[model samples]
Target: MMAHSPGDTAFLPSLPQLLIDDAVRAALREDLGRAGDITTNATIAEDAKATAILSSREMGTVCGTGFARAAFALIDPALKFEALVRDGEKVSPGEKLARVTGNARAILSAERVALNYMMHLSGIATYTARFVDLVNETKARVCDTRKTIPGMRAFAKYAVKCGGGANHRFGLDDAILIKDNHIAVAGGVTNAIEAARAYAGHLVKIEIEVDGLAQFEEALAAKADVILLDNMGPELLEKAVGINAGRAILEASGGIGFDTIKAVAQTGVDYISTSKITMAAPTLDIGLDIEIA
Candidate 1:
């Protein structure tokens, strides 16, 4: 993980090279299948060389450059991949993002896999940025939830950071989040909180979800480190904040979209976690155009 920058809220620490290489290698393996780029091998000579330019077709925040580079490098180590803009930077339509110069066959083989990562991750970053922009004036920070595509949680969460949003717990093991289901299973909010508190190490902070004021009071009395106000509208959220009185970190979640996020932020919650940033984001249109020379 990269160090947080106080000045650039959108600054993202680079993902570990090993993780990037592993993901890219898997994607390339899947794409290549039993035989590798048969079309390229049949049509383009192995000695053929060319330059390909990656350009954005729509305005969006850029991400996953390292993944793209890894794709090309793993395909052919001699290939040169240069990123014109860093991850987390905003780009306009038709803006050139990266240039790849080397064996034409290698570029062709890696194109789709590279674009697949860039487009999907950039879309998440773009969507997350919109939510971040809407809530910029408030104390509330936009956050990404666990509702991510399986096997891609880390990438999705990294995209959220690129878009100027904070990440929630990466997985269930990282933190103890007592949701309504947990509360019900444990008999009550107080019971769940107490059980979690007793089981958790001193470094682990416990967060509980509550839908109404009564549950909120129980969670507060139980001394949960963080309280999630689930599906509550602005009015109820504001009231919850008043009830909280700085005793715990407050997060408002559920049914939050671009339309309602601003209102929710103004309710004085510390964070707003939504799945739309990752699950519902459309792929940003980016294309790779080869310039054979």
Candidate 2:
């Protein structure tokens, strides 16, 4: 499958089942440990069955329904997990996101893991949506950084898309991003871009981070595919935009918040990347309530 870019907002694709299965399996193993859901084993009868509903307790976007379904299916194939709403859809309080029916013990065993993925991902989606909404009127798109939980980058990025945000390079291998450290090691911005250009294949696009107008001018001269305007407030960003005159894709990043995003977007940057979407997002509150039937 082709990687989703910051511009692809209309169609949100599901992650590969193999990837989902691998992640869900590891989580289940971590949670189950050596003995496995002992509390459920000790309390619930083996043959007992029950129904449960996964409901949102607060307003937010929904994500990770597939992961939640995988959690239940992996625990017990007999469990029937049904998604009431797809990922990227908004939900209000008391909305049911999914329903699970089957062995009561399996439902109980998988509940926490399911909720973990959904709640965490939904949080990122909700937070990203806020940023996206803030910049809706502008040409700038909100994008996510790699500041995600170590093993959860793919899942987190997917959630960002669900919330209407764009994605930056998934990893170092996908694109050439010359940061300050890379430039320092290479001796200068021009040298760094030259080195990356020589080494990277034609399919790769080169992007460089610049802190000042001088460096931005150098990057523009180097014909970098994308230029990251780091930590430039509204005034500086506007100046950078004016200087560019549509030479390359301009991205404004660094310390951008809800209050200032609109101003940043208004400066006419193509994208705004932030770590807050993945790092500082609050988990959306969701719960599984066992049906009394």
Candidate 3:
């Protein structure tokens, strides 16, 4: 089953078996290509029985264990998958998170696909947790942006939540954000804000992106619900906040790094969004060592 979103009450007791099936199927087709597992086919009996443990090679948060198990379970329903650690729990190098024992071919076939998603998603969660930790004592909440892998945004956002970060719009439909290009196209901030408010549904909030204090004041004058103060240093951000005076939700964007995030948080923005969290987060170091037992 997919891990529940943080604070989510809804439970996904089991994923549609098809998600696991399709992901594994595509992975196997890619890895096998035209040759199949040549070494396994050549050297090992098709029905060879084996037992293996899933152990971590680095200290980090555990994620996607269920999905990893789902990968193997898809290959062999009776494959023993015992998860010794829960998703989102901290783990150490050499710690055993799960054990799988079943047909050797099934275990070998599912290995790579299982490791790919687990490592990738866990990396996202780990890095997000880092940013979350950076601002734990402050008022700002770490958030992830649209800079996500194309087909895996939902899973990526799920990982962000697992790491104590919140998700922005899953896509364009959920929010209306007017940027520099839109302001230029519409002739000015006034035109852009007016057009957005007019064209948007009542429930669709309007946020305007401004690059400097002048634009911020214009945006506040235009009555934007959220003002994305782009690349503003803490001093300017403070000035912008004083200008805004609680009339809108203040969001800080651009120039955000671990060194600068806490100071930006101190600038009194409600949230800080960054593509760096997703684009720059390295894949967590994780591996599966399979041995016959």
Alpha-carbon RMSD, candidate 2: 2.6
Cα distance off (Å), candidate 2, residue 120: 0.5
Q: Each candidate's TM vs. the true structure?
A: 0.96, 0.96, 0.89
Q: Count the backbone clashes (under 3 Å) in each candidate.
A: 0, 0, 0
Candidate 2: TM-score?
0.96
As for candidate 1, its clashing pairs are none
Cα lDDT of all candidates, in order? 0.92, 0.92, 0.79
Residue 234 miss distance in model 3 (angstroms): 1.0
lDDT tens digits, residue span 1-293, model 3: 32223343544222355665676667667887897777777877988888777777887766677678878887679889888877666677888878888888888877887888888877887787778778777777788888888777777776777666777777899999899999999999988999899899999989899999888888888999999999889999988888777999999999698899989988888888987777887887777777744
Expressed as tens digits, the lDDT of each residue in 81-160 for candidate 2 is 99999998889999999999999999999999999999999999999988988888788999999888999999999999
Q: Which ten residues in a row have the lowest lDDT in candidate 1?
A: 1-10
